[model samples]
Target: MIQVLFVVLFGAVAIWFAYKVFTTASMMRSALALLFSMTAVGAMFLALQAEFLGVLQIMMMASEMVVMALFMIMYMMNPGGLAAMEMTHQKRLSIAVAVVAGLLAVGAALFGGWPLATEAVAAPAGQTRELGLEIMERSMLVFETAGVTILVAMIATTALAIRRPA
Candidate 1:
């Protein structure tokens, strides 16, 4: 009962923060909202008894959010988020897309094929090894593709941000 309650609370918090992330006009505020949303997700994992994942999520998100905040401060005109402005484009279309996306996500959550844990839980070391194998084997291509994509994006961004002398 308590677990469910905590999970629901954190889920609500996450949703609220995520909404704020998109709704806020300030880049910095949006970044902070994203951080809060992810932290709430981590808290939900902890509530679900996924200690390793919870800690990893929180640590990774905290660092990533810091980096994002720094980037916004350096690159954005209004990183302090003091001025109110329209943050989104095509508001009606955006809301329509959001609704469709939300429905799809709910459908996936309800109907996705998830494997059941049939075997006994492994020891700590064994579990760590299993996680490594899963990441390195089953999800290797996805990870590698994401890494390459991120590398390319960073390079492109750096190039674009370089100031040319007049």
Candidate 2:
């Protein structure tokens, strides 16, 4: 089915980003990887017919993530991009073992005979359009407020990250 294929593709991309996040050596790399992973999640939301949520994920999380990464990079004194620096103690073997164990556990749960929720309901036709209308009508203020907050946070972070003359 198309849905299954979309889910699989999106999941594979997310997993690749997760691998980059886990294996990267520094804050900027992890943040950049996390940004990609979040974008993949937003894409998955779109595939699942959650358009509002998908847009929110991109507008709120992805932009903030990039801003945070830039702030970190700007503030770092290393002069290098920080990707080459170690952010934590090396424990590759332990991390690999833990990742394998977690994967097995997730696989077991996924394959387990979990019953579908009978109470789940489908949205009516034109549901996304209706939802968008409602948001525009009633929740526009809240949405605008969130955007302002994101802008303020980005400005504050930039201000904080800038270096002062010695």
Candidate 3:
């Protein structure tokens, strides 16, 4: 019963924030709405006992939204989106695509032959610890490469900022 309530709550929040993301005039607000939506999705994952996926969703969205905001600030004339502006393009086509996509999703959900787990599975002990160990063991090199790439990008950005206009 409590799980059902939480699922409903998180699902509603996700939908609300997703709507806010598209409807808001402010770019920052839109980005924040997207962040909130993603966080709510993470909450739903948690409610469904997908701890690793929940944490990953929240963390990934947080970083991505921060980077998106930074780029908006760097490139946009009105980073705050205080001035009213039409953010969307191709409204009619987008609506058409959205309608079709929504219908397809609903159809699949109704018609898909998904197998239900008959037996309750035991939860793993120290799931987080195990996940951390697995990630470190398999993806240490990937993380290192990503870190180096970020460092290089930061250096390049600093160099460009400091360069004098000829």
lDDT of 1 by residue, 1-166 (tens): 9988999999999999999987787888889999999999999988876667888999999899989999888988777678776555798998899899999999998899878777766655676688789889999998899999999999999999899898
Using lDDT as the measure, name the better of candidate 2 and candidate 3.
Answer: 3
Q: Write the per-residue lDDT of candidate 3 for residues 1-166, one digit (tens) a residue.
A: 9999999999999999999988877778878889899999999998887787798899998999989877776887776777777666999999999999999999999999889889754364567776677668988888889999999999999998896978
Ranking by lDDT: 1, 3, 2
TM-score: which candidate is best? 3
Model 2 spans > 4 angstroms off: 25-27, 77-84, 90-97, 104-108, 117-166
lDDT on C-alpha atoms for all candidate structures: 0.88, 0.81, 0.87
Measured over all alpha carbons after superposition, the RMSD of each candidate to the real structure, in angstroms, is 3.5, 5.7, 3.9
- Please identify model 1 stretches exceeding 4 Å from their true place: 108-126, 133-166
| Model 2 TM-score relative to the real fold | 0.60
After superposing candidate 3 on the true structure, give the runs of residues whose Cα lies further than 4 Å from its correct spot. Answer: 124-166
TM-score: model 1 vs. ground truth: 0.71
Question: Clashes per prediction?
Answer: 0, 0, 0
Tell me each candidate's TM-score. 0.71, 0.60, 0.73
**Candidate 3 at residue 154, lDDT?**
100
> Which 10 successive residues of model 1 have the least lDDT summed?
119-128
Identify the candidate with maximal lDDT: 1
